[model samples]
Target: MKFKNRRNECVTTSDGREIWASRSVTVVVCIVLVCEDQPYILVNQRGTGVPDCQGLWNLPCGYLDYDETTTEAAMREVWEECGVNSLELLQGADCEFFSAPWDISSTPHDARQNVTIHHGLHAHVDRLPAVSNAHNEPNETADIRWLPLAQADTLEFAFNHRARIAKYLSHLERVAWIRY
Candidate 1:
């Protein structure tokens, strides 16, 4: 089914089912490393040239590229924004844990022209890379920092990343409880 018209802005199939057009898909990767017996997550501040959220902190994330899988896109974003190579550091991350699509159409500060399908995943690392720099996408990312999970929860994040981080934190709590 297609959009009814430019003016109508809604579509209906012959069976009267509403159709939704997904504008784009974005992959968000939360890289976690354990240091000093505490878990820290990688975060980046948006640089000046970013379309929005300049100077605001967010998880390593970006739009899914045309010819890349979700995992590939996530890896690329992590490298570009956090200077970490997931392929080398990830300690058997279960990518499927956070593969579900989240419809962020109604979220505040979200784009209204297109629906955003947010896919998130957590990459647990045993150690941090010596140089975690945002060199590839210099304009899109400003500073890279690793914050303790508890401290990260207190900071405001851009692009609804706080929700994604909360989900990861909840999962961590569940896993810890299960292990106990």
Candidate 2:
């Protein structure tokens, strides 16, 4: 997993202390899947000049605002992080209570003392109509790439994006098989 400079990046101390470039902040990230005939995920690159991972590949994600529901936060994250405006959060991942390796300059209430990372899974209802794809608008993201799970696993993402993606894929695979 590589990292890049972006405003939404998380900040942390060398010894793994959680900190944010901004004070009192909430970060919300969503692993968006365009589940059509096949399953593909949305990823974006954080541009330069952010507290955390300024230049690295990551799943569609960002920090939550002051007053936003987790579900709404997930949807907004997809849009701001990558540009997928329309999305629906299917299920939530509880593997980790709190999101860890805290990106950005903001820290959780007890982030400095505790290290846990959590995020939600949002799947798009509408098909792309085109190939699984995205755009990298300069400024925030230099580029965007939609990779199939198989090929996606081969990618090097920043922080725990890869792990999170893998976890979501495993869950999806299980649900898919159970349905059949």
Candidate 3:
């Protein structure tokens, strides 16, 4: 099925199952930082009061508000969660879509089906922020830190962030020849 302006579309699986497009799409932005030739990612730990994935580390991310572009939402989330106001989108880092309820069940009895659009971003900063909570939502984020890419796999991450980070790192490696 297709909607006007193509806002939504339906897909049919080989098994003869049809899937409807999600009504909500969230944008997950991975902010990359390089220091002394080593790469790092800005991540936040979900607070205990958070509704989901409490205590798990994840990239600075948030849902796209009504009428807000992905770029705007990414920048806003980074600033609010990490206090980093200067960021640039990585070249060739296009958005990726991931479906929720991996089972691909047509009947979602709980949370509405969601599609997460991931974006990669880069920023140069002299130092990391000492304190977070800039957005004043403690339950959403407990703490923020810069984690070395090599050590990212050591931490428990929320959602599919670990895979997303790996994808971003692969992108960086592929485009290493390009300057800025």
Candidate 4:
């Protein structure tokens, strides 16, 4: 989170078009890990170099590559973003999820997408920590924190990350909001 926060940070690529609307190209699969020993949630300080939501705080996440299932994408993203190796470490199927149209409105006319990658959130308890979060470059991650749940919202994150995380937590809690 060392990078500058560009309020209204709009991610747009122009092959020379001048329209002004925002769009999400790839589906982002994210996860939250609850540690058993410490009543803390694991979150990574996203390296500012990562494309798009650079310098922002988010769950360990990555884009789904071709032909990957929702579960596959989530697992792959967890591995890529956090350096985790096995999905077996986690054991659960609960999350809070909300999605809007992945937009390319800001892009050129050719930015139409036939395939829509839905944004997914997956969470589980980590029996043990893994190497997925470790990077040789400090820029990738300056530090990892097992932030307290009570104060989790105080920290800053990009996109609708906080909402996504809170929503997932709400789902896991079996709250009444899900019916709406």
On TM-score, the candidate that comes out on top is 1
Listed in order, each prediction's TM-score against the native is: 0.69, 0.56, 0.68, 0.55
Please write out the lDDT profile of model 3 over residues 1-180, one tens digit for every residue.
Answer: 864433467899999998876566666776666667666778888887678888899887777797887667766777777776533333322322222111121223345445566666554445544546767466778888888777898999987689878776666556553122
Give the residue spans of candidate 3 off by over 4 A. 1-22, 87-112, 123-126, 129-131, 178-180
User: Predictions ranked by lDDT, top down?
Assistant: 1, 3, 2, 4
lDDT at 39, model 2: 52
Candidate 3 to truth, TM: 0.68
* lDDT agreement of model 3 with the native: 0.65
lDDT of 1 by residue, 17-129 (tens): 98764555667776666655676778888888788889889988888787887677777888888787767664465442334433244332334333344444344455656
Best by lDDT: 1
Candidate 2 — which residues are off by over 4 angstroms? Answer: 1-36, 88-138, 174-180
lDDT of 1 at 85: 72
| Alpha carbon lDDT of each predicted model | 0.65, 0.52, 0.65, 0.50
**Residue-wise C-alpha lDDT for candidate 2, range 1-180, written one tens digit per residue:** 876434644778899987666433334453445557455666776777445677787876555566765446556656655666533233333122123322233233433322223454435445542322243334567556666656776766876678766665555456443110
Clashing pairs in 4: 23-103, 24-103, 82-132, 82-133, 83-132, 84-132, 96-168
**What does candidate 1 score on TM?**
0.69
Instruction: Kindly report which residue stretches of model 4 are placed more than 4 angstroms away from their true locations once superposed.
Output: 1-38, 91-128, 134-142, 175-180
The better-scoring model by lDDT among 2 and 3 is 3
The candidate 1 region of ten consecutive residues with least summed lDDT is 101-110
lDDT, candidate 2, residue 40? 62
